[model samples]
Target: MTRRICISGASSGIGARIAVDLAREGHHLTLLARRQNLLDEVAEQARAAGATSVTPLAVDLTVPEQVRPVLEQAGRFDVVVAAAGANAALAADAQTHLKGMAWAAWHWEANFRANVLSAVTLLEGLRELDALAEGASIVLLSSIAAYRGSGSGSYGGSKAALHPYAYDLAAALGPQGIRVNVVAPGYIAETNFFQGQMSEQRHETLVGQTLIGRAGMPDDVSETVRWLTSAGARHVTGQIIQVNGGASLGH
Candidate 1:
């Protein structure tokens, strides 16, 4: 059966790859992102990849006011992948930035809005719009940094909040037949996560930390998400699947 999937951050990286993968499987895709040009590019590619239908929605997730209107317009969907905030992971010198309480507060708010509230706003809008189709599945993007205290304190803290939120949401939406899950990825190269922001030394450290001896790709996370939304994962919900290649073990 064809699926209607709505994905945020669909302009690039993991989000774009996820949209394309599902589209290639003949799913209808509604792609949302901050950049209109990027979204259009992804949407066109999705159609070329065999998506039954493709709709591009350009909106920034940071501004709470912009979320609902776009999601409302996407209409109903069988799956929602809240994959926003790939680029807002952390600063090169996050430890220094975290020295002051004001900076700490700002970092916390920034990460929270980007990583948590963005998904929440979309969920709330879907609820209000009655847009989540029956047996709908929701996937929220998280990170291995959020699991172990090895990266930006603010970024991890913001992502940590998502675990409890997902658990509660799974229970809250269960009676309504909706399932919520979280995915925490390790060092992913396809998203250009380490470019310019992380030093080469730090990059080597992260790579060595991964048992797989390499960084993950956008497709790594996308495949995990695809499974969660598939019929095979119907029994799976409120779980966190780490795509870190065993990096968490070292952490």
Candidate 2:
């Protein structure tokens, strides 16, 4: 059956792939992203992939003012995917290795705004808008870095914060037939996460840690999200499903 889905970070990487995959299943999609051009591109791809309808909303998830009003009018959603996130330390360049409390504090705040509060704002908007359908599933995209130290500053810390939040959200929404869960992926390739700074040695080191002897791809994570959002996973909620090819094995 087709469902109405809302996805953040739907312009690229795993989020984009999930949108297309779900679109192919003939679902209606409302994509949220910061870049209108990119979001439009993904929307076209989703349309070509057989979506019943696709709406692209360009707004930064970190800005509640922008997110709330837009979501309030997009109609109710049967599924919500909170996939917008970034490593502030990496984005700021070389800040991850710096050794200063002040630097760490700034990095933590930036990462929190991007990773933690972005999702928070999205969910808050949905709640206030009454945009979540009964029996809806909410999936938050996370990283194995939350479980195993990435040494990339507070990226891991921010993602770790989502776990407890999902647990509480699940309990609160369970009676309403809504489910909340997180999908934590590891070493995914073809993503903008590395900011084009990944070295060959770093690639090998990451793959070596995985028992599967291969790094993950966007679909690896996206497919897990697809399943979790389906009726087949109705019994699952408030859990962090790791798609890391055994890397860190949830530590």
Candidate 3:
């Protein structure tokens, strides 16, 4: 069956991959991101990939006010993928430990908004837009940092927030057949993340730590989302599926 799907952060990386994968499944997609050019690129690719229809809305999801316009047009979707954020102010306010661990208070708040609320407001705002289909599935993008601690201020903590929220949402909405789950990925490449933060040697070291012996790709995370939202996972909800290559095991 053709399903309607909405994906935030669809301009690049894991989100874009997820949109394309679903598009290949003959789904309709509403792709959201802050960059209109990139979002349009993904939308076109999605159409070419077999999506019956693809809509791109360039919106900065961190600002709650900006979401209203996009939501108005998103309509209802069988699946909603929130993958719109990365650790804010990298290296502790974009500086480094050489600059000290000093970070402004607003920086911590921004981390919360970017990582946590980016997912929360969308799932909750669906009601206002009438944009949540019955038995709809929502996948919130978190990180392995939430579990293994990547040494951060609020990046790990904020991502951790999404895990419990998924559980609460599932319990609250399960009666209505709605499902909510989370994906916590570790060391995923092909994203703007780690740009300037991770060195080639460090990347190699991290990959070595994973039992898989390779860095994770965007497609790896996207494929997990595809399964979670598919009918095969109909009985799965409120779970955190980690795509960490076993890096967190025996920790």
TM-score of each: 0.92, 0.96, 0.93
Candidate 1 local lDDT, 46-164, one digit each (tens): 99999999999888877768987887678898999998874343545344444567666766777788778877888788888889888999999988878775355777877878889
Query: Candidate 3: deviation at residue 174, Å?
Result: 0.7
On the 0 to 100 scale, the lDDT of residue 124 in model 3 is 78
For residues 180-199, write the lDDT of model 2, one tens digit per residue.
99999999999888888789
Relative to the unseen true structure, what is the Cα RMSD of model 1? 2.6
**Clashes per prediction?**
0, 0, 0
| Candidate 1: C-alpha lDDT | 0.84
- Top-lDDT candidate index: 2
Taking the tens digit of each residue's C-alpha lDDT, what string does model 3 give over 3-88?
A: 98999989998999999989999988999888899999999999999999999998888778888877987788899999998777
Clashing pairs in 3: none
Off by over 4 Å in 2: 92-99
Ranking of candidates on lDDT, top first: 2, 3, 1
Model 3 regions more than 4 Å off? 91-104
